[model samples]
Target: MDELSWFRVLNPNSKNPDGHARSYEIVNQNYANKTIAEFTPHISFTNYRACQEYATANLNAGCPGKSVLDYVEEDTLELTDPVAWVNVGFHHTDKDEDQSPMPIHWQKFQIVPRDFFAQKPTITEARSCVNGPTGGAVNSTTRPCIATNTELPTVSTDTEDPTTGTTLTATPGAWNEARTTWNYQYLWFRDGEPITSLDEEGNEVGATGETYVLTAADLGSDITVKVTASRTGYPSGTAESEAVAVSGGAEPEPEPEPEPEPGAVTSKVKASATKVKAGKKPTVTVTVNATGVTPTGKVTVTHKGKLVGSGKLKNGTVKFKLKAFSKKGKYQVAVSYGGSGKVLGSSKTITVKVKKK
Candidate 1:
């Protein structure tokens, strides 16, 4: 029998000084190809007592050379049955250390057994029938043959302003997945699109898993969020999760407040005297036509670029008196609706001809 066919034995009793029993085999001397007994001795209360009785009885009954029994003399012996079977043909070794050992090696089978019932199939072989020859055959079966349990991991999105280092919390929606455990091939997305870096060019920066971390740049204005999940095992190509939009982050500043509409006022300034005599006062009137603005402040009159007179407008009109006009051939007169800083309406400039008087 092969090494796999030999059953490993264990000792269970604490009182037993002997440790666990090793693998052992039983073969027929007349028909070396045939196996008589293939089992490991059990060390439990029941099995240990049974093995002890059997070993003692067999050793006393059969001839010492033909019947060989090996056991641990510990308080108790524990053992397990051989889980698998293998073929070890031909040579034999000495049962005790005193005996000269035979050179035991693997020998070819004299004749290959055809569908032998004695040899049992391996665990892997039993499972193979359940899982057909083709890949993913289990999923295609109409009846449920396989059951799976899944545990989804939590995911979060975080963003920080590069300049200010201000942190912003991004709301990470639910990660989508057809099944909890992926088929172990292809990229998986928590939302919709494949998880990628926040760079301008969407690159495959993250690992090929369901969870994804989005940086500040990735959460920019143009970026939209969606979850996608996929794997190779399923025949549906790639399975996708639901799409979820990410929220949070500083919004752009609002447009500047509109400036107040300009005051509706039109003013005209003119000189009454065409020719002005030296040391003579020149009379001037500043008229304004404004629908909204109330003419309340004093009007400033200027002649030849000099402040000659000042007066207040009673009802959108102002008349001013000029004193001691300087000697000149001609001069320009400008009237301001309000005096200096108090200007509210409008201002107009007119030509004034000055003559020697």
Candidate 2:
């Protein structure tokens, strides 16, 4: 189509240069064959009269001068397998500009983006790197996003010494750092039906909270405390205590074992950039810490809920170089420290946005 005039679609309010779809075309002096006659006269696109005529026309009939739209006599435009018609012209006849050794003349145009991106793709903000004793230089090229997780957090129920006249205590599971909000609910079930009681406020309630005291009605019956936990981004979860039964008669019971003190290790994750290009790796640093002690552990990394990488900690820090994603979008990374004998396991998560290279 280098011998005819051509044009492009434009959005007047677009922020892109020339307000077009990132392309430029100039009017010329030649015409291109983009009609049904030029369409190879093969398969019919629809049952319309124009489509049937174009598909069955003989080659000798030659291409028509009128545009494709002229063939449609109907008021409302409707067609299958639509095709665009564009013509470009560039006449190369004898002229002052066509001298034997005339310098090459060039015309350039481009379609710039407008709203394709919510904001500028390269407008990423800098972030702090995870700094631990064993830490290396922080990555300075990645773009960061708010990370989120969908996996349900671990949930468990605890009971006070079962021998202490059937007193039960419930301890909620730890919440993930990515979670923004959550709550807990306690319930007791017998023979698959819920058992409830009136709270001190005289409101009817189920066996609730972190503690439960056995009653006379519980004798010779199985008791269970179920704790339901929820967080902002992850799915809600319920954990039930192992079924315990009230004995037939009062008898001497073994002393309950003391609970082990929980470790105090915590961890944080830092990413080189919140935004990165597809096929470009992003460096992630995880720092493990304990309030009053040095931390040691094997760190595991997960994207979403799937494990992606793992490594051993050195000087309370672990680093991971994520594999380049083949496509562009937001991805979440979770780093967890599987604590040593003196530390507790902890995790941190962050979000990364991938862009075109």
Indicate which candidate wins on lDDT: 2
List the RMSD of every prediction in angstroms. Answer: 31.8, 21.1
Local accuracy of candidate 2 as per-residue lDDT tens digits, 1-357: 332334444434554422334333333344334453443221112323433333223232343443333443332555644343322222345688666786675433333333544335564322221212313432322211212123322213254334335666655544332323457777765423467878789988776666677776665445555667653323455655545555443333323322324654444433333366554556667777677776665776667554555667788776776644534688877766666666656677777677753
Over 1-357, each residue of candidate 1 has an lDDT whose tens digit, in order, gives 333222222323422112333223332222133343422321112223333334333543332322113433232433443221223335454577544654445443222222222123463321322422433333322321222212222233354232223322222223223232333333433222344454557644743443434445433211222223333332222222222233344544433322334543443443243445443456676665544454455566665554656776676566655644334456666766542222334567766665553
Report how far off residue 162 is in candidate 2 (Å).
55
Residue 83 displacement in candidate 1 (angstroms): 99
**Model 2 stretches with alpha carbons more than 4 Å out:** 1-274
Provide the overall lDDT of each model, using Cα atoms, as 2-decimal numbers. Answer: 0.38, 0.49
Per-residue lDDT, model 1, residue 233, is 31
Give the Å shift of residue 106 in candidate 2.
44
